[model samples]
Target chain A: MEDNQKKYTELANRIYDLDGAVYECVGSSLGRTFTGGRERTVRTLSMLMYTKPDGHLLRSELALISNMARTIKNKEEKSRMMTEYNEILMEIEKLPDVFGKVDILDDERVRLNLAAKREKLSENDHLVICISRTQGSAGNDIGFELADNLKINYYDVEIFDQVMKRLEADKDAVNDAENFVDFNKYTKKSGGSLKTRFREFNRYHGLPKQDAVFFNMSDLICNLAKTEDCIIMGRCADMILKNNHIPHISLFISAPFSVRVEHIMAVRNMNLKQAVRFLKKMDRQHRKYYQFYTGEKWGKPENYDLCINSANYGIKETIDVIRRMIGK
Target chain B: MEDNQKKYTELANRIYDLDGAVYECVGSSLGRTFTGGRERTVRTLSMLMYTKPDGHLLRSELALISNMARTIKNKEEKSRMMTEYNEILMEIEKLPDVFGKVDILDDERVRLNLAAKREKLSENDHLVICISRTQGSAGNDIGFELADNLKINYYDVEIFDQVMKRLEADKDAVNDAENFVDFNKYTKKSGGSLKTRFREFNRYHGLPKQDAVFFNMSDLICNLAKTEDCIIMGRCADMILKNNHIPHISLFISAPFSVRVEHIMAVRNMNLKQAVRFLKKMDRQHRKYYQFYTGEKWGKPENYDLCINSANYGIKETIDVIRRMIGK
Candidate 1:
């Protein structure tokens, strides 16, 4: 990937160098105002008269000169400037090459072609899109919206429902296992005294049932992949598809902690303490679940084709960006 | 998480309702300009005189009235406008309240306080920072920069070196094992027919030696964590620390694929194809390695305290943002 960028960068740099030389020939550097007074004015006037004023430059120079001419109070000075401009114009009329330097246009075209080639080479495989997101990042919302816009099937609880329907797995048992594992971690971190009763229940129950449910869910995910192009949220879908050699675009959506907490606080009507605790607990469970089943970090950027911050970009813009990325 | 966000949305709606009423008292709707003509002007003038103008409102109103006066065509009309403005000014002078509405300021203060509170709540376990990054996201660069800025001890391959020096493990064999695991998956996905020779070599040689190396490295990581606050890069340090109940901030850094590819291409002096291939292989190995031992997603955002895009924000800004986030 790095090597690819280098070639493009090298091409870009070369284009800039060639273009810069051409720019110097016609006067004025790219991205800078024409500041060299009389010399710049003369060169610009000559270029305008000689070259087919590539619309942008022509419009700018015409505006500048007309504005500058308007500011001149002395008719004699204005007439002198007009004479210089006309002299340059007459000389330009005699020139063979109408475009001051053709190299810049050629260079720009080459640069664009190189960029296009690089883009083409980096296009992604798009059989499926597996979206794994943090709890409060609005990953599910983005997934549903993306699936709707892309007109692909979306599977969130449907994946769990499908597995449950097919395998007769107890949903409550799975939830208990997931909650227990996360709760156990939190309790262990917090010294376990406050959650003794829950700990006692979890200690006897364990996560074996959850493990069975997860394994079956993995198979169900693979089966779904074999059948359709869909947007699957969570459930370690990205990992499952990758392991099975299924082509997919994996997406991870996240937001900064403060934004997420605020989101929770507003949505749950919880105080700061409650919102913080809820966010931490939910995130812990998600991490544990992904780690347990896929042995991969749930929110790792590399695991996904796109990593978006819903809070940073907002849902609509993020979705639009994703659509453009997917070429949909 | 969705439940939590819903409550916050409810509270925000309530705040808007309350604020809207207060805004109506002030004779203008929030976030909208008064588009009504003479009646609006009279009401605004009356409000400016009768009610106290908050500094923000005073500034805005002064600017708006000054701009409005500039548009008067006739000298007599302008004089009349000035007289009316002077009357309002005189009335404002007699009034005791300089600012009628204080809700906006109070609202702003509440927002700041809420933000501060959230920041305080998210203050992390800072015993160690285990940074997991993508192959060409400049994760190591950011890690080194972060460690230097925070004045913490930094570890990248120092852990591997420490483990290797202690165990005398065959480094080449370990590399071969890592390469093999990554290559194995790729070939498996590609149908395994063409790369059979490489697979045969990897299958027999296996990763036992590397596994030994990894185990020793995990012990080294824990021992180091027991001693000091340091930033450790890669080698699934985040996972090991988490399981051991060591308090740490795990960070995942990544960039878009094209950006990473360009980085690798330039840094490694490889062509686009070579860079792309290299990145894929390296990433696969990193993922496999992290999952193999830690059983966690290598780049999952949930696994980290913060996840940044070096390409999106740029490395310097990303580092600064992380530093601010960590309060270092």
Candidate 2:
């Protein structure tokens, strides 16, 4: 719990630092222009990070503004601009204090409801949690915390890695299968001549290497479920468990794109552009991978017993909810 | 389509006007306190609307700031504040244009992809679309637009309104049934002394008036489904149709909480606090209503054929996807 609090504080400080940089840029820009408001400042910053092709403010753009400002040769105007700049700097200095207050507000909003103590359970008790999360929603962190709290084994990408290793499989095989499946889908959609299409379909997915990997992975997951209580993350574990008639709580965690972009930017120390690109790519890959294997939509609520927004309800609070659910 | 464009333009203008007011207030406030920056301006505006109990900025707060400004007696300091005030007002004057740019960005974001011309279908073509949406997700608008585009009838609140009128029912009875069901849920959760709880449950519901109303509403919806191709919205219509084994597409539409709040605030002409309150209440009411009838979690993906985010993909693109699905 103390570690959790420390992590949050660290995150809060990171946000403060980023917001500080943005606040300074906005203040300086406004000081120079004397023609834009707070909304314009935020919009510019957001656009630079979220919508700009490069996903960040171009230094060239800043330099261009500076060049324009330098061209204003009137001595009086230049002196006035300096005064405005000084005033803006003074305001920028106070931003940390304002952000401190905002941090407190966010803390209040995210306070986790700790679970009550539960009765002792026998070793044979059946409990499995399959948690799937969108990229940048901190699914891994939540999975770890929930597992630690529940005193259960946690499996994530490492499990998939170990299984692939055991099978002596190449990862690219999965990509090939995914690509083949995707091509099949497009061809099916386009509708070619019947005989040609039937031949193509038969040749397309004849138990490809990726399907072998998934089959092996599902068997591994089912074997794990039968052995002990555990929290499994991703790799279509939920669908596999469901097919095996394993009664378990399936959970999907997601956040808004904006929130996720912010999270990835902060956590990964990536600029806005990189973060957006990374998250979008990951989401698409996960969706395609899940859909290809299960023939079901990824992150669809019906596939999961619980669908939650970790960004809306804080991760700790979400875990708390899950704890209560497990108890029931 | 032209009317839709007009409405969006009007909404953008409304946002511009509101932002103008906020800009003025922020400008004047900043002029008084040279220690504040863009972050402070936005935080203050957000707090005034979203956190304040009255859901708006109080006149008294503005007056107090004025009074404090009047008390500052230093000539240089006073003159400096006035200069800052003038500069801020100058910036405020340029806000409409800034907002115009943002509006265009938003417009680009929400642009709908109109569907390709679809083939004509027979009257008994077995096409029913049941759409359930989060409050303020513009579900009703989407439903109406989808129905119009498909040249099918749309049923929403009016259907429930008609059903209630025919049954000579009041809305509170519905609320009571929801409450009774919620209580029964608690009793079940508690696993109370079985005999007493069973008797209490039997005596409590006993074919309540609200259930009668629901029965009629369900009948009305099912009859409508039998008649023609149509889109049904809300009042657990999706669940009702599903129970009746109606062949249809069930869709669930959702948006991020902040997006939904903004939608309600703008469209309902409510302050941020009021909008948030109203949406939360409506969501709770809906969850209870749906759970009471279906004994299923509202907004679960399994209950629907397609789950979408209007905020993510825009309403028009969502409609386009639905159209393609229906055609297939």
Candidate 1 lDDT tens digits, B205-316: 5544445456667787888777766778777776777667665666678865777887766555578999899899888777776777767666655455446656544455
Distance (Å) between predicted and true CA of A176, model 1? 35
Q: TM-score of the A chain in candidate 2?
A: 0.52
Give the true-structure RMSD of model 2.
32.1
Question: Which segments of candidate 1 are over 4 A away from where they belong?
Answer: A1-328, B1-20, B26-126, B167-207
Every candidate's DockQ is 0.03, 0.02
lDDT of 2 by residue, A1-328 (tens): 4653444344333333333343344443323321244455544533332322221122122222332333345666545543543343344324332111111011111111011112333465457778898877767767765765665666766434433453444444334323433433334553558776566545436554445556767887898788867778887887787677655556677765777787666555578999899888888878888888888877755354445555533555556656644453
Best candidate according to TM-score: 1
Candidate 1 TM-score, true structure as reference: 0.36
Error of 1 at B151 (Å): 3.0
Error of 2 at A145 (Å): 34
